[model samples]
Structure formats: C-alpha cells, structure tokens
Target: MRRSRAALMAVVLATTASGTAAVTADAAPASATRATACPTGWGSLAEARAAATTVPVRDVGTGRHACFDRLVVHVPGASAASLGHRVRYVDRLRQDGSGRTIAVGGGAVLEIRVAAPGYRPETGAPTYPGRAGRPLPGVDLTGYSAFRNTRYAGSFEGETQFGLGVRARLPFRVLVLDGRVVVDVAHSWGAAR
Candidate 1:
C-alpha cells in the first residue's frame, strides 16, 4: 500500500510540472505582442528617447502617473523636423487580480488611411487575454475623445500625421500581477492620409 501511494504521488507531481511548462510556453509571446512601429528614420525606442527633450507630465489618474518626451530632428538645409512624441504612463493597482500595462507610440506614423469619425474600420481590434497573439487592433483607438476625436489606428496610410506635429502618441494602462507584465490597456492617436 505504501508503494502504491508513492507511485500516485509521483504521477501527481509529473502532471503538475507538465501543466506549469505548458503555461510558460503560452506566455512567451505576450510582451513582444504589444510593440508599435517606430518612425521611418528611428530604429528603436531608446534611440528616439535619446534625441527627445523631456517634457512635463499630464493627466494623472488614480494609481497612475504620466510623463512626456519630445525630440526635434534637424532637417537638411531647413528647419529641424519634429520627429514624434512619446507619453509614458503607469498605473499600479493594489486590489486582487491587479496588473500593469505599457503604451508606446510613434505618433501619426501608424494612422489608418481612410477613417472618419463615427465610421467603423474594416478590421476589428485584436484581443489577447494574456496569450500568444499579435498586437491589439489599432481600431480600438476609435471614439476615445482623443487628441482631435479622430481614428488613430486603422486602414489609413498617408502622412499619418496628427497632434501638434509628427510626434506619435502612445498611451498605455498596464497591470502588474505579482511583479510581471500582464494585461495591457493601450491607446494611440493618428490622422488620415
């Protein structure tokens, strides 16, 4: 009877280990899934931040704080080009099932080509409940009383310029669960082509 009990315990341990492994495999892609396309000239977020001059924060909410950054690029034989802007905001909830999200934007560079207010996009937003998937649909950006009440993400594809200049705005509400990045609430603003 003791030997039989030991065998049963070993089986339970093996099953639990396998379940944990499966969950980790499923989570490998969530972080990479939430990235936006940087401007044409800039390669990465760090590079863009290096060129940007720090600005003041706006719109702080409960458990949330916001900060802004601006970068002015010197154009050839002309006025310096304002590449884009970034807003970094974070919210930490202390309640049960709490989490954190991050939002980064390349500004109007990713605007949908032919979107008008009150018009839905051809594609729907991507939904990822902490699983392997692509970035959430930019279409979710519709109807948020945004910078100009415009459709920031969709099929639009031209200058993609919005806001004060070329700077893209990326707003995110992240949830931190037990010190890990999970459940992201991200928003962006862009103009039509």
Candidate 2:
C-alpha cells in the first residue's frame, strides 16, 4: 500500500510538469496573444446625453493603446458629474451652428460633443481656439492604428464639437472622468482572452 501511494504521487507530479511545459511551448508572443484578447464588450452605439455644464473645454488630445485608440476632451475645473457628452458615429461631420460639412480622413467618423463652451464663461474669451473645417492644431494622428484624422467641428452656444475619423465603425466607450471626457475605440471586436 505504501509503495502504491508513492507511485501515484510521482505520476501526478510528472503529469503536471509535462502539462506546464506543453503550454509554455505552445504559447504565442505577448502582443500576438493580446491582439486576439481584445475587449469587445463596448458596443458600437451612440452614447447620448442632453445635460449641459458651464465648464469650458480647454483642450483635446488623443493616444494609442495596445487594443484601442483614445480621445480625451479636457474640461478644466469640472467634475465627472458636472459634465455631459454625446458620442456617435456620423455619416459626415458638420460644424456646430453653421450646418457646414467638415472633411475627415478615416473610413468612419465619430462625432463628439461636449456640453460645455470653448469660451471663458466670465470674459467670453476663447479657451479652445479650434476652428471649423480645419485639423486641430498640434494634433497629429499620423501613425495611430485606429485614428486617421481629428477635426474641430465648432463651438456654438454652450457646446464644443470634434470629429474623430477612425479605421471603421468599431466598438467604443465613453468615460467622464474628473476634468475630462475619455472616448476609447477598440482596435477590433474580438473577445478578450
């Protein structure tokens, strides 16, 4: 009985070691594995909001992640609960209050509207000097995997607008963080591993 128990333990250990080795040998590189493990939970749909705020938009920026591209709208002195936004896929980007179409470079355009003006509330001075039908100053999406262009639609009344041109109408999500509104567009609609 003692000899049989010892043999069983030895076999179990051996099997576990071999299994681990096999998995290690068959594993893909980290980046390749992560490409297939991209998150797909963020659906491709219009995220709408009607609420407004007094905080003015300060800046707009973009970044690239491993699985997604990010667009951030900076609204200084504003809390997440104090800001409102609307993000949706659009056939063509149009300027706010002008009804003029703005040309974007990507296969699809994501329209972003923040419920805040681009002007200082106290003095009405322009906080974000972005103009309609022009590429945003200092923003270059040259090598980004998902983003092709970034254009300023306009700022009218109490809202600021932007047009994000992407590779396709991909899954996306919006996050209203403190002092900012973040939009993430996934590289693909694959299931995360």
Candidate 3:
C-alpha cells in the first residue's frame, strides 16, 4: 500500500510539471524579445518620455525649468516614514558623466551596483537610437554599495531628476532635462520581485 501511494504521488508531481511546461510553451509565442537600438540622443523630450515606457535608455536635454514644478525622484525605498533615515542614496554632483563629486543635495554616494552579499558594479548597456520596437536591456544595480547611503548615479545630461543614477537590476529609462532626472522603471530582469 505504501509503495503504491508513493508511486501515485510521483505521477501527480510529474503531471503538474508537464502541465506548467505546456502552459509556458503556449504563452511563449505571444511576444518576442525585440532588441532596442536607441540613438546617442533622442530628438525631443516628448519622444524620450514615450521611449521610457518601452525600454532602457540614457539621454540629456535643456529647457526652462517648469515654472511651478521642480522635478525630484527620491531614493528607492525611501518614504515619508523613513525621512532622514540612512537609506542608500544617490544625487547629482558636478557635471554629467564627469566622475566629479560634489554635494548637490542631501544624500550619500552610490558605490556598489547591487545590494546583495556579493555584488559588483556593472556598466550601462549599449544603446542605439532610431531603432523602433526593440527592447532596452535593464540596468542591474541590486547589490551595489553606496557611499554614505548615496545610491544615486550621475545625471544623464545635467538634468536634475534626483535619485536618477546608475542602478542595479532595475530596468529603467532615463530622461534628463535642465536639472531633473526622469527615471522610468521596467520590470527587473535579475532582481527579486
């Protein structure tokens, strides 16, 4: 009787696995992984915004700071409840991509890429423009270490979108204008959900 029960259980498990595999196979054909080729610079801000929803990106722009709004993106995982708390942080310092460090605001510097036990900083993926319907590879910064809770990467092109810096494992599209960093997050490809 015991042997029969064990055999039945094994059959049930195998059937479940096969069912899952079949479902996955059926869903696979709905969409394909299209690669994105974003150009060095996007044509306009509106176009950039539209692109953000679709894939990974990095861009810069200049314009009149919106009269009534100063765009700001807070550190990930930050909240009103955690104000003044030492959360890994990132901010704009010096010029864009200059590697210069200056305190533009109150935050720490980003050091590590991902925030796991053994993680290292990674580079931004290759980008191309004028290639429509392609997918942008997401940035992976999950285990990255920050200097003094500063996890913000540098600005895209001197834009002031705070907390818009190099991130790990977070799929994002960046739009930099004036003094703001607009970050659009895609689904993370290599981080815990």
Each candidate's TM vs. the true structure?
A: 0.15, 0.80, 0.19
* lDDT, candidate 1, 3-122, per-residue tens: 644654564465333221111222222234444232222121211111211111111111100121221111112111222223232121111122222233424322211111111123
Count clashing residue pairs in model 3: 46
Measured with C-alpha atoms, the lDDT of residue 3 in candidate 1 is 65
Over the stretch 82-151, how does candidate 3's per-residue lDDT look in tens digits? 2221112343333235555544222222221211101111443332221111111232233322101122
**Least well predicted 10-residue stretch by lDDT in candidate 2:** 17-26
Candidate lDDT (C-alpha), each: 0.22, 0.78, 0.26
* 1-193: candidate 2 lDDT, tens digit per residue: 4664465456446533322111121232344433334666798899976677888998887765546777888887888788899999999998878799999988899999999998987888999978788898777777677888999988888989999999999899998877888888887777653
lDDT of 3: 0.26
User: Where does model 1 exceed 4 Å of error?
Assistant: 1-105, 108-167, 183-185, 188-193
* Candidates in descending lDDT order: 2, 3, 1
TM-score sort, best first: 2, 3, 1
Whole-model lDDT, model 2: 0.78
